[model samples]
Target: MSHYDVAVIGSGPAGTMAAYHLAKKGISVVILEKEMLPRYKTCGGGLVYRGRRRMPFDIESVVEREFKQINLYFTGDDKVLTSLRDVPVISMVMRDKFDKLLVEKAKGQGTEVKEGHKLTGITFGAISTLHTNQGDFQAKFIVAADGALSPTAKLAGWKETRKLIPALEYEVEVNAEDFARLSSEVRFDMDSVPHGYAWSFPKKNHLSLGIASTRRKKIDLKIYYKKYLEKLGIKEIIGEKAHGYQIPITPRTDGFHRNNVFLIGDAAGFADAVTAEGISNSLWSGELVAEAIFESGLNPEKAGRLYQQKLEKDLLPELHTSQTAARWFYGYRIIRNMLLKRYGDFAMSLMTDLYIGDRSYPKNLMKTIKGKIMEIKNPLM
Candidate 1:
């Protein structure tokens, strides 16, 4: 058995990031990954600007493409809206490359990256024992950054409270003509998946297309994806890879940590409610958790409290606001269409600001929406 200050489960963004920070502060940390590095991960692979900017090191080496412009198609093609930022609005990446880069950075910070160590069980105590496929290891703290279906969270006694939504993504290679036609910009088609949206994020040589609905009900994503492909005029198919997963847009009602085990990222359901984007918050939460433990001098209770405070100040509040925005943005169809048509440009800019980490969600969102509805476009209505 080996012992360390912290043992992290999984090497995804949250886990690797936490390990990186903790190791930087001289905490002995090891990341036990179930699979080898550069493994395929199911994601749309669109890293928003804010997330890219937050990285401690440049990720240019792993980046596939960058776009400063966004094209949003709402309801009908006629209702399309566009926004351009001076900085890249979204950076494209393959998770395998992206995640491996993160792990390498953490390793550089003195984190031990133990690939092929699958966490089978954990024994809780002042110092917890982590049973892995390779062997048993012990640590004073554990960071559960495993992802949406976090087994570590369950082992640490957390129940499901997150609002998990279904999403389907495909890596598609089209003919030269189709590739040329769609490869220049990033686009999202709203109302294509009922309350959700469909996105086309162009990679260096292919397109990562996906659909996600915010609604909790049952729907055929394949059916919607077929329609979306038709909508994109993608008549020829070369090769495609498909993946289906769930996004936890709501945070867990249960506590984030117990017995020195802390949950971050999708394990704690920190993805944005509106966008269902988890990487930004996941990275943020991982850093905070590590900071809390380091600052608290490894005091379990104090670290947990500090972590909660950090989240409440920034990440949690935004998630709450995102939930409110998502309710209006997705659930209310008529208002959504109307508002998108009338204020699409404004909305686009607002989202752009949020994506760039320049602004927070408005305080009185519903009030502002009401004002917009009653004040403008009087002639048409």
Candidate 2:
């Protein structure tokens, strides 16, 4: 069996990010991908500024579009909430290109990716053996950065405890007339789906349109998507490709690290609770785990503790606060609309602030709501 310090399953953002950093630290790391490189991945492709700022290298080469302002629309509300910034708040990317570029960066740092290596099972020990269709390999640790349907997490002894919601996206090419009318800005229309929202993101040549909901089942995403197209006033379509996927809004309850295996990104359910965005946190978690392992000097127990501590200090708390906010925002629409009517732009802007990383979700959401009702000065901060 080929030996390495760490074996990372799946070459998505989380895995590639970890491999990149670990290799930079002179650690022997190999990424195992079940598929070939530059494969198509289902994603909305919107990278918020908070995530963008953390990139160690400039990503302009792979970026399709960048917007300094974003718009939020409600079903009946005529007034659109707009948040503008001097710097681009969101950058669009096609995952095929983005993932490939990240893989190249990791390769530059001495990371090796063995494509078409589908992991079949794992035999755990001081040195674990990864059983893949291609061959078996031993590693001191394993990083499961594979997406939501991760077999690696299961093989590593994790029970399925992540709250996965549904999402559907279509890479649509509309008539030139319609594209011209719709391609200038990034917008999300709330109330377009029950307990969720629909978004129209402008890419280099087409629109990445999709819908997602916190409600797990009994939701017809296509029906809502059809209605959304009518709402957008599209005259004709030139081409279209639909991709349906899941977004994990809740982290797995059972710890992220076990038996010398570490989980990051969707495998650990690090997507945003309120917005269902995950790229940023996936990158964040991968970086943190790399640091944990490096700092622990390859001690599995020490690495696990350090990783847990890193998550608890920031990522876990933010996710918890986002979950509470999502409940109010998506689960209870009446209260949200009422507050929107009163606070108007201020309320939406506050959430956008959370999106742009200017301010974090308040530790005490109930107190914040009460302060708003009491009309306390600066209640809408």
Candidate 3:
């Protein structure tokens, strides 16, 4: 069987980033993907500004639309709050094109990308063997970036379930006029996407809309989404078909590594609990794991520990902190509106940074709390 220094399963952000970095380090690497190139994925396709930094270069060429504002719709549309940022802080993208771009970048970096190849089974030995349709291959190290229901994680015997939030999303072609009005702001409807939120992200000639939630288990998403569209005064559906996927609301903290295998991204449950955004986290984790492996001589346990330590110290703590704050957020409308009105653009930008993995909400929350405490201590002054 053919052997490589590293084999990565999945071609999503995590796998692509891992392959790219490993290849850049002069390690032989191969990335296996189950889908054809540029295949559509179920996503809201909103990328916040700070998270965009993980990419080596600007991805504006692949961006579908850019926006400078965020509109928050609370309990009632009458009490809407808006925030505007001077610079474009968000962009709407088509995942098919976006993911394909990164995968191509990996290829350009000399990482072998095998498309349309599904990982069937993995055999563990002195060198782990990955069974794929093209053929069987062996590797000294394996990176499982295969998403939430990862087969690689299972093969590695690292199984940890998480609290999952169901999400239904769609990208639709709309009137140019509507698209123009939508150009600089992302619309959020809290009423319809209860427990989660419904979002409308504008593209050049289309609109991306979707709803998600953890509480609405067993509820009919299509029916709920149709009702949501009605409330928005949208009478028609256009563009691509609606698709649904699960977002792991609570990430697994078990440290995903066993034998010669390592897990990153959704497979490792690194998606942020509040926004369900995983792209940047995936890339960050992938890079860290690759670094750990390279430094540790591919020792699974040491690499896993180092990866987890770095994650907890650098990232997961913030997510865990956000998880607590997100609970307080969905509880009532009054507090939410107050925060929107008081914080305004700053809050929205902060959240954008948080979602994209640039800033930690928990860290900011403490600062806010500290500021308030100091204010109370010197009230008269």
Candidate 2: 10-residue stretch with minimal lDDT:
372-381
TM-scores for every predicted model: 0.97, 0.97, 0.89
Model 1 error, position 221 (Å): 0.5
- The TM-score between candidate 3 and the true structure equals 0.89
Clashing pairs for model 2 are: none
Judged by lDDT against the true structure, how good is candidate 2?
0.92
Candidate 1 lDDT over 1-381, as tens digits, reads: 889999999899999889999999999999999998879999999999888887999999989999999988875658678888899889999999999999999999999989998889998999999998899999999999999999999888888989999999999999999999999989989889989999999999999999999987898999999999999999998999999999999999877888999999999999999989889888999999999999999899999999989988888888888999999888888887777777888999999899877898887888899888886757555
Which of the numbered candidates is closest to the native, going by highest TM-score? 1
lDDT of 3: 0.76
Model 3 stretches astray by more than 4 angstroms: 238-240, 332-346, 355-358, 364-381
The per-residue C-alpha lDDT of model 2 at residue 126 equals: 97
